[model samples]
Target: MQGYILQIQKIKDEDCIVYILTNSSLVKSYRFYGARHSKITQGYKLDFELEHSMTFLPRLVNTMHLGHRWLINRDKLFLWQQFIRLFYEHLKELNDVEEIYFNVLEECALKLDKQNAKRLFIEAYAKILDAEGRLHNCDFCFLCDYEIGDKVALARGFLPSHEHCMNQNGFDKDEIEEFFKTKKSLNLSDETVNRLYNILLDGF
Candidate 1:
């Protein structure tokens, strides 16, 4: 089966503990000589088998990296890693999550090389919010509980707030509404995208 390596921590000798997110679950497995597996890192996808022993932790074996061209670019890879870690924090406590979670990552990773990572970051986060049933209508202020006027500020999770209510001038309301409806960060400035993406780092 295939899974994304969310995290790996070194143990005694070259052994390590790995946390992986597969289509249906979050898994913790062991790997001896893990240091030798340079391609197995946060944000990299691997196809592998897990060995289970009654008295021992599950073991990772027969791994193959499904590499991406963007991963070799240090900046792109770093952003990808940062985006991937959000899944670990969000899904770590659950034994199972909706397949949409994994699908969102898969879809986003495919486009990482083709689009601006920040744009994809915000758009991917919107996908997650939608899948989880939290992408609310954006016509009102999340804080002040009033109709939003010309512009809207986004709190974490993209809940909309009126710019005046927020004491901040925000992205154009139509653009934000369009983004929520379409899941595209079209027309959002790089500066605007960076702000939205930063909110995502605070986690869903």
Candidate 2:
């Protein structure tokens, strides 16, 4: 999907950032200035030039939508919450989960060990869950003939029930690469990665 370009500048107060967004022919603005010694209850309006772009998905985004109404509706927060829960459950099963995962991702310019493989796979899963307009996770397993401890392999980033399930619910290779690049950009450290992984695994 083509991402919205955010142009940011410091506000006159020097505490907040004024962000201007441009997409296609649309221009929009928002202001974010953190309060001193406390949190801010901010207000925002997404002023896009075209009202429809504010609601409609582009072609690539539609593909990622995965035909899930839970994702299609903005008020259905459970869809995201459930996916986050599942992600943590899977992470708990890995031995060197965090250290092997985030540390290797932070150092993606270099090659990694076999331990890094599963972490890398899970990271991709987490990111597809994080994308702005899609519910990529839970789609396959929820309706498939697979169990939690099942060893699944991914084709084009889709974690199908098995290799046989690849053609029916697989993602494209480009989708996998996109998730990898996006997760690596987060630059999460080994410790923080482990902490989050453990928290999720522990069902927090």
Candidate 3:
């Protein structure tokens, strides 16, 4: 199976608990420490086998690291970690997460070093919200139901609002609309993009 390692917590001596997000599920497994044990860490995409036992956590076997070329760049590595940490935290509550979630992670991991990391993250997150049905796609303000004008503001959960409703201004409605329609923010200014990304950081 292939998955991204979301977290690792040290247990008793020579043991640890591993949280992994696979293509279709979130899994928690046990790792017995050993010199030969595959080196696992948060945000690593790896291919491995699992040895399931009746009474113990599934054991990871024959782990192989994949798509780690981004690690060679310090900036990309930092951004990649931040991206995966957010992804893991957002999906931890669900056991049967959609496969699109994993595919997004893989896509982000591969493209992290290819473009502006912040831009890549925001685009990927937009797709995630769309996939999870959390993206607000209406023409009216989410807060007041008023028609959205030239400027807009985004609230937590990516809900669109009139700039005045949020006591903010300067976000172009067309750009946000394009983002919702295409999951891409090519025409948005850096300031607007960062504002949207900040809303995401506030939660969901």
Best by lDDT: 1
List the candidates ranked by TM-score, beginning with the highest.
Answer: 1, 3, 2
The count of residue-pair clashes in candidate 2 stands at 1
RMSD (CA, Å), candidate 1 to true, equals 2.0
Worst 10 residues of 1 by lDDT: 33-42
Write one digit per residue (lDDT tens) for candidate 1, span 170-196: 887787788888998877788888888
Q: In order, what is each prediction's RMSD in angstroms? A: 2.0, 19.2, 2.0
* Per-residue accuracy of model 2 over 1-204 as CA lDDT, tens digit each: 211222234447644332221222222233334443222111111222222346532211111111222233333333233323443344433323333323322332122222343244345445544452332442244336664233333432333344355434233333333544566514554644443344234331
TM-score of 3: 0.89
In model 2, state the lDDT of residue 128: 42
TM-score of each: 0.90, 0.21, 0.89
Candidate 2, residue 90: CA error in Å? Answer: 3.3
- Candidate 2 matches the true fold with a TM-score of 0.21
Q: After superposition, how far is residue 184 of candidate 1 from its true place, in Å?
A: 1.0
Model 2 local distance difference test score: 0.33
lDDT of 3 by residue, 47-134 (tens): 8888999998898788887866668888877767777778667887878888988898888877776678778888888888888888
Which pairs of residues collide in candidate 1?
A: none
